[model samples]
Target chain A: MEFSSKLLENAVNEMSQLPGIGKRTALRLVLHMLRQPATQTNALSQALMQMRTGIKFCKSCHNISDVDVCEICANPNRDESVICVVEDIRDVMAIENTSSFKGLYHVLGGKISPIDGIGPHDLNIVSLVEKVKLGGVKEIIFALSSTMEGDTTNFYIFKQIQDFDVATSTIARGISVGDELEYTDEITLGRSILNRVPFESSLKL
Target chain B: MEFSSKLLENAVNEMSQLPGIGKRTALRLVLHMLRQPATQTNALSQALMQMRTGIKFCKSCHNISDVDVCEICANPNRDESVICVVEDIRDVMAIENTSSFKGLYHVLGGKISPIDGIGPHDLNIVSLVEKVKLGGVKEIIFALSSTMEGDTTNFYIFKQIQDFDVATSTIARGISVGDELEYTDEITLGRSILNRVPFESSLKL
Candidate 1:
């Protein structure tokens, strides 16, 4: 669509370049901003610029943080000996929201997807291995997805630390808590049956 | 959801305040931005801020423009005697896209919505009346939506210009061009039948 203003056209072009936003959606968003107070737009732009410019990642875990060391890694209450390995910061946030895990995290940044030209080297796997090799980690839990790329990365990292004294495990794969048994996919159902826990263990939760 | 970084949280909060975006979609967009080069984020923020800060409205038509008078109002080719009144710049853009109207536009900024506390004073109706009062305009076409608010605003503006000699008209409302008759709403279908044009006029098109 033709825009009368060059500035509006430029802003819409930039907005539509984002992942899921299309030209129509970008226009709607731009028009919404125009209707609101200028201060609202100012706040949004300021927050985005400040976040992009001032953001940092945790030196140890590689999760996004406002400081050199993220809150999870720096907290003394979290068990540093048990590290949960995951793909990115969003995973870290999801796990943290559960409040079930009391351990630290190792963010791999991304899986080993060869189709996208992203290999193990493109991730933060080397730093994770170095952290594990330092030898205080009692157990490294693989919390990546069940995709083939996730499995490959997990196996490669497990090999790198196999000779170390640390024990290795993976997060359990099963049907989601609220999912129906008949609707569950075959692979997940099979895995759930194979990895079934004792009845007494299930009662504990 | 909890975020490790305050800046990230702030940015997401601001982004999600937009019309259709929710927390999950906001997180996905923010994560996509984080994965891209810092320059992309910088460009987006810069363009948004610049557009909001430096944008101007046309003095004559009130259409958004980079100059005192918009390109349409300033163009000698456009018919200054016939003014198309619209609710906003988007409507003007829509009408322009048709490539049929060569008349100047008068943007009302918004419709009259009592539920939203918007009235005639909140719009650019006075300037529109003044344009007609200046005595060169021969006709005023109301190109607003057929909503109740749109109709009220049109009537209010019509009353203001009724004392003048200029003719007044509204855009024709009926079944859409390619709509199926069975699925068309009764009000529109009835109107289409009642307002049917002469067969010779139809052949002229």
Candidate 2:
């Protein structure tokens, strides 16, 4: 399709690269953005640049943070003895929004997908095991998706940390299927987190 | 909802100001934008800025253009004697995408919505009438939406040029209902354009 201008084309191209956005939706979004004031557009542009520059993975939990440790990991009131493990920063936000979870978090960065060449070593699994091995942590909750990769990662983490005294668990699975975690609302995700089951005994086979 | 950063908050606020985007969708879009490459983000930003600074409405047709007149209006092959009247530049684009219509276009900028304080004066209707009055225009096709506002605008335009010998018509209403012209695909829009009927003379009251 012939675009109105070069800038509009560029904006649409960038927007279309997003996960759910197609060319038509991207065009709609770009047009919508254009109708806004210049300050708004400038703010969006500045935010994108600043997010890349200022936000870094927290050294402790690996969640996106401005400081060395993320807000959840740094908070003294949160339970340090229990760590909820997840695949990305978005999961951290999801759990945080519930206001029910009192524990800290450890982001694995990604799951072990063999097809995508992401293995246990490629993730932050070693650090998770080390954190457990240090001996103060009482529980480790796995909040990975219900995909094969998530299952593999969960199993690998279970095996690696079996020697430790830490109580290992995985978030409940009944609410999710396939590659659908991205579609799950916060309430469903929160419910899954709340009903986590012991993983070592469940996956012993 | 607590945002991770000020920049993120600003971007979300800006996106939420758009016609259809809610705060949640805006946040989702901002987060999605954050995952993109710097070059893509930069391109989007550049496009937004450029769209604001570079694009101006065509003097004759009111279609968005970099020069005095849009490409369609400036083109020699387009039928200057037949002016297709549309609600906006996007309607012009929808018609142009068909590649069947050889006529030029006149964008009204918006439909006549009395509830929204928009009227014939708010649109480019006066300029459109002036263009038609200048002589050689044989047909003035009203390619507006089927909404009440669209009907109102169409009637206003019909009244403006009733004295002239130029034939006035409206695109066929067979495919859509109420403010749905924006959603109609190019093929259907093209068909509608081709099957337009002359304004009923009895409804002049």
Candidate 3:
């Protein structure tokens, strides 16, 4: 892990500090930067610095944005009364890709992971609950993942806004659309069977 | 692959331009940067810029270095008479890790790969020939990978240096030390047998 140049070593060390990047990968990336045109590296560095300092969050949903409100929240075409609660912008993009929902989003930033010292307050739960309390929202759909932390966050939010006269529901859990029944995990298969929709409703899907 | 913020999108796009990084991975890295303290991203950006601008190569062997002469070439203890020619700095570091060779290195930067439009003149081959022609070098070992480009580069150098008094050799091609013989590839197993060294010579290890 020794390097001939201190500059190269320093660059590699800093790069390896990033998540999922190991020392070897850092070295490879640094060397690639060295091989490419200086402008390429300059552009990359400037872009990262500018993004870190200039990135904005939507005031409404706390999703990453270039302005006070994200595009999803700003769009009049999107159904504002039906808010989809998600963990981050990635989930927002995922649901948007499916084109299944025309609702606005309330990004929580991250789930309530107590083990990681992240509680409900660490996320955007306060803003979300306040929005529901304002009384325009009709349905709040929990679109967070089905992990323990995701479930806890969903339950905590539901408890806070339950008496506000807003309908609360969760995304359906089932085997993936194209997955085989034999390959479905036990818990997912069991839940799908237990919550099986009426045959006529399934036919609509 | 859409982004919520223009700054975030720019950073992710630049990041994804790096080898082996996809859009999803780029987004993940950018998001991680956003979650971290601003100073972390600043440090990474500064380090990369400093390394790119200030990095130097050894004037003697063309290896990446902090000064005109590299450590291995400057060291008084290393053998000045023998030289190991390698493809790049990574190979130099790999051989150094073995701690078996005591000679200095000549890094060619890359092999002669015509498919990549790289030629002998494009590499440090001319300087290597000049070094051999100067008559102080006693032996030159071709330590490049055993690929077609590597062999082509090796043969091209050998052709230029054949008239010189220096002896020439290449790294041995054989089964790895701890590898199972039964699983060894046929070409390597065949070559290992065909070029077998004496039993006593191996037993000396």
Candidate 4:
């Protein structure tokens, strides 16, 4: 059926475009926005706008930030000796929330997927290697997903950094498979971090 | 745990403030946005900003619109003589979605809730009465909820228009109590419209 207003229809269409939001859910959200006070609606609008205009990927870690370097990278107190490699900024945020990780992060932007045309060169792998070669990093934690692509990316990174004196480790995949690291709850994530094994010892590659 | 960045935290906080969104859902939405292409993220942000800056309530019907009069109110094909009185614009959209009602709408803004300090004057009741007094109105279909506040508002409107010759009617309350008109599926809504009873005759108030 045709919607009452084109604007409402447009808003719903936009909302439905997002992952997990169906047409019905989008409709409900749009209607809820209509019921909200102008101030609240304005705040949501401002936040959304600011998220795009104000934030950019950090040059050092590839994590989203309003400045050149992310808060983690800019913080001098954080350990520069350990670099946690993640597939996305969400994974970095998830790890940071635990307050247990005092190290810096390296967001690969995405996992290496041959079918998806995402190769090692497509990621920030070169920058990671360059950072490692600069010589302060002692450990490289592969906090990527346990998927095929994640494994491929991890193997490629391992090959590229074999010459470095840093210890290479992958976040434990004992109980996690077919799930993004970002989706794993904090408790599970913390456990996984503590239970992580040496990549060379576990993968034998 | 504290968020990774202030902007991300702000976005999450604002999203959580939305009606049904919780902290986890807010985080999911933010992460989803982060994963999307720059253009898609920009579209969402632009839509949110435009929803406030471009949209305004139609003066004639109080429905959300980009122009002064809503598309429904401005449409010449709609039956201006038949006015559907509803609690909100969402109700108006619900009715319009059916394509069965070609009538114009008068949004009461909200129902009478004295406990919540919402009196008759707090609503757009005066404007509704003025519209009825202008003449040429043949019917007024009250499509309010079955709640106490909805019933009270219906009664007040019924009393005010008792002197007028307009055929006063109401959408059927066959659905259960506390059921919002917006939440009722389109098929049920259409059926309710088909089986609507005369307000004055059925209630006998």
Highest DockQ scorer: 3
- CA displacement after TM-score superposition, residue B87 of candidate 2 (Å): 1.5
Q: For model 3, what is the error of residue B72's alpha carbon versus the real structure, in angstroms, after optimal superposition?
A: 1.2
- Relative to the true structure, how large is the alpha-carbon lDDT of every model? 0.92, 0.77, 0.93, 0.81
| Model 1: how far residue A67 lies from native, Å | 1.1
User: Whose lDDT is higher: candidate 1's or candidate 2's?
Assistant: 1
Candidate 2, residues A1-205: lDDT per residue as tens digits?
Answer: 6865565676677767766678877777766665667777677666666665666667888766667776778789999999999987668778888786899899897899888777888788888888998999999999988777888888989999988898998776555446487788777778778876688754753
How would you encode candidate 4's per-residue C-alpha lDDT over B1-205 as one tens digit per residue? 3665678878889888866788878878877887677677677766755665566788988777777888888899989999999987668767776767889999888899999889999888888888889998999999898778998999999999989888899876455566998888786788778887788875653
> What DockQ do you compute for every candidate structure?
0.79, 0.41, 0.90, 0.35
**Can you tell me the CAPRI class of model 2?**
acceptable
Give the worst 10-residue stretch by lDDT in candidate 4 chain A.
Answer: A170-179
Alpha carbon lDDT at A171, candidate 3: 94
**Compared with the true structure, what per-residue lDDT tens digits does model 3 show for residues A102-161?**
999988889999899998889998888889888999999999999999999999999999
Q: Model 4, A1-205: lDDT tens per residue?
A: 3565667777778888877788778777877776677677678767765775666888999887777887889999999999999988668768877676899999998999989888888899999999989999999999998778988999999999999888999765444557787778887788778888778876652
Off by over 4 Å in 2: A173-205, B175-205
Candidate 3 per-residue C-alpha lDDT over B1-205 given as tens digits, one digit per residue, 9 for 90 to 100? 8888899999999999999899999999999999999999999999999999999999989999989999999999999889999998889989999998999999998999989999888899888899998989999999999999999999999999999999999999999989999999999999999999999898764
Please report the TM-score between candidate 1 and the true structure.
Answer: 0.95
Which structure among the candidates has the greatest TM-score? Answer: 3
- Which 10-residue window of candidate 3 chain A scores lowest in summed lDDT? A196-205
Residue by residue across A92-181, what tens digits does model 1's lDDT show? Answer: 988888888999999988999999999989999889888877778999999999999999999999999998999999989999998999
Q: What's candidate 3's i-RMS value?
A: 0.7
TM-scores, all candidates, are 0.95, 0.81, 0.97, 0.73
Error of 4 at A192 (Å): 10
With candidate 2 superimposed using the best TM-score fit, by how many Å does residue A136's alpha carbon deviate from the native? 1.7
Residue pairs that clash (backbone atoms under 3 angstroms), model 1: none
Kindly list the per-residue Cα lDDT of model 1 for residues B18-118, writing each as its tens digit.
99999889888988888899899999998998889888999999999988899999999999999999998889989999988999999999999999999
- Identify the superior model by TM-score, candidate 1 or candidate 3: 3
